[model samples]
Target: MDCCSPSRRQALLWAGVAAAPLAFAAAEPGAAAAAMPKDALLVTDAEVVTVTDSSVVITWFTGSATQTDRYGAPAPVPADTELLLGEPGNPGSTRTVYHDTAPTAFHHAEVHGLDPGRTYAFTARSAGQDAQQSTLQFPGTGGSSDAPGVFTTLQPPPGRYLFTLALSNDLHMGEQTAGIITGNWPPAFQQDPGLPPYPEVMLEALLDDLRKPDRGAEVLLVAGDLTSEAKPGDVARVRQLLDGWGTLGTDYFVARGNHDRPHVGADYAACTPIPYATDHHDCWGDVFPYPRQTLSVHQVGGLRIVGLDTTTLDAAGGTLDDGQLADLAAELRRDKDRPTLLFGHHPVTYESAVTTAAGPAFDLDQTKARQLEALYHRTPGVFLHHSGHTHRNKRTFMEESQSVEFLEVAATKEYPGGCSLVRVFTGGYQVNFYKTRADLARQWSQRTRGEYYGIWPHYTLGTIADRNHTVVRDLSGLTALRPR
Candidate 1:
C-alpha cells in the first residue's frame, strides 16, 4: 500500500528544530571570548520535548558529539546541564536547576510548578559556563529570553478520576537473539548459557510489576508482537503468561504484531489461512483470536476501548482491510459521545528525532494512517491512540486535526522494560511509565543497553525523568455515564 503523500504529511505535521546559532565577532586574544576553550559550553538542538500545564521538558545536546540516531546515542562531551527558568523578567523568581551527571552529550530536564497557559523564558547553562550569545532568537515569539528558546505551558488534563489501564507491547517471546538490530554489536548481548533466557526472565518481571496493587489497572493491554514468531509453542507460552494476570478478553486485551504474523512452513499441514485475513501464516488467526476477533471493544466507566488488527495479511508492514475499516467507522458512528481509547501494533505517524528509511516502513502505511486520523477527528471521542512498534517512549498531541495524544511505548522484553499506567479522571487523564521492579527485569534492562548500542542510556532509563511526566487533557465533552 502507498504511504501518504509527502505534501500532505508535511502540510499537516508541525515540529521543533534545533535552536538557531548566534553570530559572533572576532575578539582579541585576551578577551573572555578568546580565553574560553574551543570545547567550552555550547548548546544545540535545544527544543521542547513534552509540555503540560505545570511542567516542561527542554532537551538539547552539548559539546562536539557526532550523534546520529535519536535513541541510545549519547552526546560527545560531559557537560553540567542547568536551566535558568522564570517568567519573562522576574529575576527574583528565577530558579537554577541542574541535570544528573552522565557522560552523554545530551541534556534533558523537566521543570514543574508553573501556572497554566503562561509564557516562560528558559536558557541552557551547559558545559562549565552559561550559554554564550551564540543562539539566535526567533522574531516576534511571545515571552522574553536572554538567549532565545522559550515556551508557553498548555492546559492540564481534567481533574477527576474515571478509570485506569495498563499497557505493554513487543514482548517478542521465543527469540534467540538480543540486540542484533542495534546497528552495533555488543558482547554482553550474547546470552550466556544457564541464564533462563532474557525474554522469559524479563517478561516474568514485567508481569509481576503490572500486577502490583498500587497500579490498580482495571484492564491490561498488550499492543502487539506477542511472540518472536507465530509458532504454536510461542503462541501458547504467551497465552499462558497472559492468563497468569487474568482471564483473556475480560481482564486484558491483545493485538497481533508483524513478528507474530503467519509464515509459510511445513511445521504442520492442517493449518490454512482465513480469507481476506490470515493467508500468509499458519499460526495467529488459527491459534489465537486475531482477524476473527480483529474488531473487539470493551467498555470501562463511560469510555469505549477499541482495538484494531493492523497486521498485514502478507507483508511485515501493517494495514486495515476494507472490512476492518468499515467496522471501525460503524462503531465510532454508533456513539459519538462515548470517549474512546484505541490500541494497535503500529504507529499512525512515525515519530523520530532523526529521519531514516525505516521510519515509514516501521508504521502503518501512510494512506491508512491518514484514514485513521480522519476517522478519529470525525468521531472526536478517540482521545488516546496507543501503539508499540518503535520500542521507545514518546508522546505526541495532535492539535490541529483534533486533540488526541498518541503514545509510543518501549518493549517490555528488553532495556527500559516496563509498562505504562494510564490514570483517567473526570477532569482529565495522566499516563506515567514505570520501570518494572523485577530484579531480573531490571538486570536485563541494563544488560540489553548494548541492544540499543551505546545510545541505550540516552533513550531508556536516563531519560526516565521526562518519560514519566504527566498529561492533563480537556474532558468537558465527556459526560460521565450515570448508573442506568
Candidate 2:
C-alpha cells in the first residue's frame, strides 16, 4: 500500500475538528502572512463527497492545536483553501480548480467543467499547505500519484431518464453522542457544547437539500435506524420532519431498524406494547404503524418497493419472523418479473463486508439472510436491496443472488453525512452518493470524521466507484414520475 493509503493509516490518531468561531482574519494575499509555517495548518478529513458528469464536491476540516473538544477554545484557522486538479503524471497540466481564502473550520469546494468518465487527481490545500498529510502521512511532497485523491467521473445513466429516489438510513434522531461502539477504547464524539444537537442539524439539512429542484428526488426511502432508542418524542419528531418534506407513505417510506426496537421504560409507557415482548413498549410502532405490521409493498410510477420490518422485539440483530418470511416468498412469487426494490434495516450477512468484523450484530441472522438470498435468486424482478446498520457505504454481489445489487449506505448523522440518489432510466439505473451541503450539516460531518480515532473516513467513505456508478438493465416498463 502507498504511504497515504487508508490501509496504512488504520492506526488510531487523536485529532478532532468541531464547531468553533472563525477568529482569524484573512491576511493580505502574497504578503508576509504567506510565510506561515506549513506545520501550523492542521487539516484533516479531506474527501470527495459528490461526483457527476461535469462536477464534484470536495470537503475537509481545518483545526487548531490549542483545543478541539469544545467551542471557542481552538478558533478556526484563517487560511486559503484550494483544490488542485490535474491528470495523473502531468505536473504541468495541474491547475487550481477551486479556491477560497476565507477563514473557517469547515471547507466545501465544487470543481466543475470536467469530462465524463475521465480520471483525475486532486489535492486539497489550506494555508498553502497540503491537507491529506495530517490524516495520512504523504511521502515526498504530497503529489497525487497512487494517492486516495484520485477519482474518475461517472458516465450518465443509460437510456432515457425515468424517476429518482432518495436513498438514506441511520438518521439516529435524539442521540446524544456518536461512535460509542463497545467500550471507550474507540472514543465517542458529541456535538460541541451550546450548539443544537448534531442529528437535527443533519436531518434538517437533508430535507432542505431534497427540496432543491435539481435533486429531482420524486420519492424517498429510509431503510432503518430512524431513531436513537425508539423514544416516543424522537419518533414523532422524525415523522414531523419527514412529513414537512412530503406526504408519509406516498412521497416517502421508512423501514424499522434495530435501534427502533421496543424498549422497557417509563417514557414509553403510553406507547403500544410489543406483542412478543409485553414488558417493552413499541414507541416507533405507534407512529409508523404500517411498516411495523408486516412486509408491505408500494408502487411509485413503474417501480415496485417492498419494505421489510427487520427488527425483532428488542434485539440488536434482525429477523423477518415466520409470517413475514412467508409473505415475502408469496409476494415475490406473485410478481416474479416486476422490477422491484427491497429495503430493510439490516443487510444480508452474505453481502455485508462489515459482518466479518462486527459479526451478526451488524447484519441479519445468517440463516434468515440465506433464506432471503434464496428468494432473491428465484425472483428475477428484485434488482436491488437497500440496507443500513453497518453504517458504511459498500456494494456487494452474492453468488446465489447475482441479479440483485446489495447496497449499504453510510449513516446520515455523522461523517460523510449524506445519502444516495438512485436515478432510474429505461435502459438501467445509476446510484450517486451526495453529502448534505448546508453549513451546519457540513460542520457536523467534519467534526465526526475524528470518530473511531480519526479513521472514521476510512470506513464510512467507500471507494469512488462504490459511491457513484451506473448499472444497465432493461426497465422500460415502469412509468416515470415527473416532478410536479
Candidate 3:
C-alpha cells in the first residue's frame, strides 16, 4: 500500500460488517460473552489504526453467532452492522457486509473533522446489543498537515536542539517464507510454511514496541516493502495495520519500496511491470503517495530534519535517477545552513560486511550514490543517512566522501522485527533498537524466527561533533540478530 493514500481497507472493513450476524450463529455454545452477537456480530476487533491532526481511522471486526448465511449471495456475510459516526449528540451511520474469516470479520471507519489534542470516543453496535466504545486522543501541537505532535510557537535558540525522530525500513510486510525470491517470481500465498501468519504477528509486535511511552519515537518512518507483494488489497491491509500506530502518539511517514509497487495482479498469475498495468494506475503511488523524492522539513528544537524519498525512480531495482538526484542537490542547497539529517528507504552504503557478496546489485544505484556523496561533501549539516533495505544491523561510514554515516536498520516483520530509537542531544545523538512483541510471530516461529540470525546488540551510535566525523564501536548493549 502507498503510505499516503486513504486506505481501501477502510472500505473493505465496512463491507465486512454486513456478514457479522451469520458468523455469530456459527460460533460454538458457551463462547465468551464478549463474543456474543446482537444485530451485527459485536465489533470484535475494534482498533485505532492511523491518526492525523484533523482525522483518524478506527477498524474492528464483527463475527456471526453461527455460520448460516441468510443472504443468498456467494460467501454472504453472516451478520450485518451499521457504523454509527459523528458526536454522541448527533451520529451518522453507514452499513456494511461482514464475511466470516475464521476468527472474525472486520469493519473500519475514517473519522474526520476532529480537533487536535482532543479526546474522542467511538462506539460499535449491532441489533439487540449495546455499542462497544473506545476512546483516543489527538496530538496537541503542529499544523494539521505537519506530522502529528504538539507544535510550538517559540523559536529555538541559535544552537539549541529539538526532539529526535526514528527511522526504519524494509518491513516486507507480507513476505512470510524463507526463500530467494524477487519481483519476477513470488511464492504462493498459502500459510507461509515457516510460520502460519508471520506478517500479522510481526507487525502487531513492532507497533506495540514503538508505542511504548519511553521509546520516544515521535515519528515513525517505514521506508518501504510494507508488503511482499503490491496487491491492492494487501496495500489496504498494511494501511489498516499501520493506522493502529496512531494510538501510540506518533505520526507515521512511509516511502514506497520496490516490492510495494503494483507488480502483480489480484490472482498473482500475471506479472505487470512498473509504469504499466491497465487496471493498476499508478497503483502504488496513488495508494501511498506522500510525494516522489520530496522533502519533509521539520524543526526539532534547533535541528532541521529532512526526510527524502530516494526510491522515486523506475522499478527495475532501487535507484535514484537524474530527477531525484537533482532534487536532492537542490533541497540540500536550500537548507544548507541548517543541521539536517536525511531519511530514505535505500542505503547509499551497505553496512554488514557479510552481505558484500551481493555487490551493488543489492545496494543503492551508483549514480544516486555519487549524487548523495557530493551533496554531503558540500552541505555542512548533512550528517546522517538513515536507511533499511539490507535487513541487517550495521553502520557504515562513507570514507571516500565528506563525513556522513549510514545506519542500516533490521526488518521489523522478520527475525527481530524491531525498530530503532534515536535521541538527539545538544551535542550529538544516541541510538537504540527495540524488539517487537507481535503475538503472530511467537505463534508461528519458522516464518518469523526459524531462519533468523539472532538480534545484534551493541548498536552503533554515530555522533557528529564540530562538523567532523569519525567511527567508533561499543558492544556493551548489543542484542541478538537472529530470530528468537
Q: All candidates' TM-scores?
A: 0.65, 0.86, 0.53
Weakest lDDT window of 10 consecutive positions for candidate 2: 1-10
In the range 219-327, model 1's lDDT, one tens digit per residue, is 7888988888677778888888888877777778988887776665555234666555443455766666756326788876657889888886545567777788888
Per-residue lDDT tens digits for candidate 2, residues 48-79, read 77787777887776665433344222334556
The regions of model 1 sitting more than 4 angstroms off are 1-158, 182-188, 268-272, 276-279, 350-357, 457-466, 474-484
Could you give candidate 3's per-residue lDDT for residues 1-484 as a string of tens digits?
3232223443332233222221234323223324454443444433333333344444443434343222211111223334443333333532222222233233334445557444344454443343343212222111121111111111112222334356677666556554233332212123434654566676776677666654556567777777776666666677888787752222667766666654434544343334434544344555665545555655444455566665533342457667667767787788675667677666675333224223355466766676677778898777777777666545666655436667777676654456666655454554545445343552332122222111111112111111111222221121222111
Give all candidate RMSDs, comma-separated.
10.0, 7.1, 17.7
lDDT, candidates in the order shown: 0.62, 0.75, 0.48
As a whole number from 0 to 100, the lDDT of residue 147 in candidate 1 is 34
What TM-score quantifies how close candidate 3 is to the native fold? 0.53
Best by lDDT: 2
471 Cα displacement, candidate 3 (Å): 9.2
Relative to the unseen true structure, what is the C-alpha lDDT of residue 329 in candidate 3, on a scale of 0 to 100? Answer: 78
